[model samples]
Target: MFRRFVAIVAFVALAAALTLVAWPQLLGLQRAPVLALAVSFRGAAAAAALAVAVVLTAVGLVLHRLRRGLGVLALLLVAFAAAEAGVLVVRGVGAPDVPVAQADDVTVLSWNTLGDSVPAQVVARAAAENRATVVALPETTEGRARQVADLLARQGSTYTVFSRSQQAGIPARSTSVLVSTALGRYREVTADGDTVGVPSVVLDPAGGQNAPRIVAVHTTAPYDLDPATWRSDLRWVAARCSERNVLIAGDFNATIDHLDGLGPAPGRLRTCRDAALATGNAAVGTWPTSMPALIGTPIDHVLATPNWRFTGFRVLSDDDAAGSDHRPVLARLRPAG
Candidate 1:
C-alpha cells in the first residue's frame, strides 16, 4: 500500500509538469482563485516532481536490493529535472541589459497607420514633433506611405526606404525608413520569405561611421493566441537582423508588466516587452487610439538591440492626428558595448 501511494503521487506530479509545458494558454485561462494559487506557487510543480523522484529513489532502495541501481538513476533524473525547471524560472524573470549611448544616438518611432480616415495625422504630427531619426509605418498602402514620407520629407528629409507592397513575403504593406540628412543614405536589404507576415525595412546606419542597424516590422495580430505565427514572425525578424548593432521597432501587438491587469502569459510573448527586455532597453506602450474601455492593452512597441541604450519614450494621442487606430510612440536610444 505504501509503495502504491508513492507511485500515485509520483505520477500526479509528473503529469502536472507536462501539463504546464503543453498547455500554458490553458493555465492562463484559470479562474482568479485557482489562478492565483497556481501562479503564487509555480515552483510547486517542479518541487513536487523533484520530491517524487527522491521518494521513488528511496523506495527503490528500501524495497529491494536489486533496485538500488534504479534508485541512483532516479536521483540523477531528479537533479536534471530540477535544473531544467530552474532555467525556465530564470528565463521568465528576465534580466535584460541597459547600455548607454556612445555617440551615434538615434530616436525612432513606429505606428500602425490604420489607414484612410483613421488617425495618421496625429501619429505623423507626433513623429515630426519628436524629430525621430527612424520611423516605421505598418499596414500602410504604398501610395499612402509615399504620402506620409513626402510630408515628412518636405520638412527636409534626406532618405526614405519603403517596400511598394502591403504583403510581408512580397514586401508589401509599405515599411518605410526616413532618415535625417545627417544620417546619410542606405541600401535596402532584400526580404526573403513569408516568415515575417509584414513588410520590414532594414536600415544600415553605417554612413562611414558606425551607426546601429535598425529593422522595423509589424507582426500578425491576435498574437496572444498564435505562438507558431508569432514565432515565425520573430524568427523572420531575427533572420533579417542576423547581424550588426540592431534596433527593432514597430506595432508589435503586445505589452509589458508596467501596465496592470495584464498577466504572466500576456507578458511572456508580448513582442514589445520581450524585445525590449531581451535587448535590455526601456520602452513605452503605444496603442488603441480609440482608448477602448480596457485602456490598458498596449499592443504597439519599439525595441533596441542588446548593445543599444534606451534614454526615453512616449505615446501620442492628440485628437489632431488622423489615419490609424493606434497612438504613435517615440523612443530615444544609443549604441553601447
Candidate 2:
C-alpha cells in the first residue's frame, strides 16, 4: 500500500511538470473551440506547480532515504512557482501602471489612434493638454500620422518619425515616435524593424555619457493570426530591445491571457493586464472602438523597463470617441535618474 501511494504521488508530480511545459503552447491555438483553455494558462501553470510541490512533500514524508532530496526539490519548485504566480496575479488583478515620481523627471505618453479618424484629434488634444515630452502613436496611417505630428508641432513639437507604407503615400500599419525639443536635445536614433513594426530610440540628454534606449513596438494580434508568426516577430522585437531600457507600447491586439497558437504568439509575449485595465475604459472595451462587444479584449498596451516607472496613466475615451473605435491612452513616466 505504501509503495502504491508513493507511485501515485510521483505520477501526479510528473504530470504537473509536463502541464507547465505545454500550457502556454496549448493556449496559442487560435481556432481551438476551448476558449477556457486559453484564458486559464496562468492559473493552470500556478496550479500545476502547487500540485507538484504538494505531491513531492507527501512523498518525502513517506520515504526515509529520499526525504532530503524530495524536500529540497519541492521547496525550490514551490518558490519558483509562487514567484511566477505572484507576478501573474498582480498583473491579472490590474495594478496601476503610472509612475510614483519624486521630483525631476521627463513624461511620456502612448496611445493608439484607432485608425486616425476623430481619434487623431482627440489624441492630439490629450497630448497637448498633458504637455507630453515624448509621444508614441500606433496603428496610424501615413496621412493621419502626419496630422498627429503636425498637431504636436503646433504645440511646440519639432522632431517626428513616421513609418512609410510600401507605397509612398500609404503608411505601414505600425507605430511612430514624436519628440519635443526637450527630448530632441538628447541625441535621438530611430530604427524601423522589417518583420515587426518596431522603432527603437536612444536618448542621451544633453549628449551626456549615460544614455537610455527605448524600443517602441506595435505588436500583431492573434485574431485569426498564427502564434508562430507572432512569436517570430516578438523574438525580433525582443532581440532589438534586449539588455536596454525598452518601452514597448502600442495596440498589441492580444490580451494578457490570450489563447495561444489558437490566436497569435504562444509563449513569446503577453498583455500587461494591470497596465491595460488601468489605461483602458470600462465601457469602451477593446480596440476597433466601433465593435466593442464582438472583440471584447483589452489589446492596446504599454510595458516599460523596470527602471522606468509611471506617474499617471489613463485611457482617453470620453471626448476622443469621434470617428475611430479605439480610445487613446496616456501615461506619465519617470525614468530613474
lDDT of 1: 0.53
- Expressed as tens digits, the lDDT of each residue in 48-146 for candidate 2 is 678998999999899988887688677766765665456454444333345543444555666665445454566677777767666766656656756
Worst 10 residues of 1 by lDDT: 257-266
How many clashes does each candidate structure show, in the order listed?
18, 18
Q: Please, what is the TM-score per model?
A: 0.57, 0.58
Across residues 134-204, which tens digit of lDDT does each residue of candidate 1 receive?
77776666565566666777777544655535554432355655555566756555655533455666666
Query: lDDT per model, in order?
Result: 0.53, 0.52
Candidate number with greatest TM-score: 2
